[model samples]
Target: MTKIARRTEKLTEALRRAGVRITRQRAALLSVLAEAEDHPEAIELHRRAEAVVPGISLSTVYRSLTELENQGVILRHQFDGTPARFEHTETRHHDHMIDVDTGEVVEFASERIEALQAEIAEALGYEIVHHRFELYVRKKDGL
Candidate 1:
């Protein structure tokens, strides 16, 4: 099986374990999220999925997405009320730098930030399971 197929399988199993019935709607939602390159909002996801399975209600997309996120099949990040965006959680961990002017998200990582977060979490007696660090920035002098 391909990587995408494997991911879909894992998501299916997760839903079953969570006692959530695996429906066509759920499967379609997961597929859309897995195939998405750019993180997308709920409405955007719904629109895309609708193209595949016409007449799939927006509510179905929203519910399935929320449930999938709750089950850790996907991770959600909120940036400045543009609707929470989602990315598949089976991928690597990285930070994000959002271009405020273009509304584009760029994934990046900093060892310094990662180390600091580890230290802080340890000091607080909490092992960090996950963290999201996003810097909303723009070109100051034109890049």
Candidate 2:
């Protein structure tokens, strides 16, 4: 199955396990987030969801997203001092580089950095469960 299909199935199962009834609004919300090419704030998600699901209340969007996040089907991050942004959790693990000026997030993975983190954690006799490393960088314009 495709990643999107797999995610949809996982999300449905998560909702069932959480005892949250899956409704049209909730399904639309999950679909928007699952197909998000970039991390999107709740408002942006609300807009897209509304486009696909008319009369879907903002509160419903918020509630549905909260449930999805709680179930670990989505990942939330806050950079640029803005409201939390959401991304599908089924994608490959990658660190983020945020452009401070433009408020863009670029995903990157560094094997060297990952190895160094493992070495440091081992030296400290701690096994890492999870870690968040965000790089805030600026691009030089050829002005």
Candidate 3:
């Protein structure tokens, strides 16, 4: 199967495990979610899903997203001053940089930053369990 198909199947299975029936509309939403690269808000997701299969309500989108999130198949990011956005949990560990002006999110991973966080946690007599790091940035004037 293609990557998107595999991801959709995985999402479908997750929702099924969460006791959510996979209706045509919900399946469309799952397919859209699986194909998403950038974090998208619920309304954006609803719009996309509606294009694939009309008549999908925004409230249904929200409920399906909540169910997917609860099933640990997706992650929601509430960046400063923006509506909550979501991405599938299959992505590798990474931090985010949110463009303050454009509301764009960029993902990056750094071993140095991870190690530094671990060191800081150890110095405070604690072990790093889970953490989220985000940076708000704007484009340089000339760049």
Candidate achieving the largest TM-score: 3
Pairs of colliding residues, candidate 2: none
**1-143 in candidate 3: lDDT tens per residue?**
99899889999998899888888999899999999999999999999999999999998899989988998989999999789999989889999999998999999999999999999999999998899999999999999
- Candidate order by decreasing TM-score: 3, 2, 1
Clashing pairs in 1: none
TM-score for predicted model 3 compared with the true structure = 0.97
lDDT of 2: 0.84
lDDT of 2 by residue, 89-127 (tens): 877778999988888999999999999999999999998
lDDT of 1: 0.82
Give TM per candidate: 0.81, 0.87, 0.97
Local accuracy of candidate 1 as per-residue lDDT tens digits, 15-98: 787788867776787687767879898999888877777777888777777777788888888998677888888768799999
Regions of candidate 2 where Cα sits further than 4 Å from its true position:
none
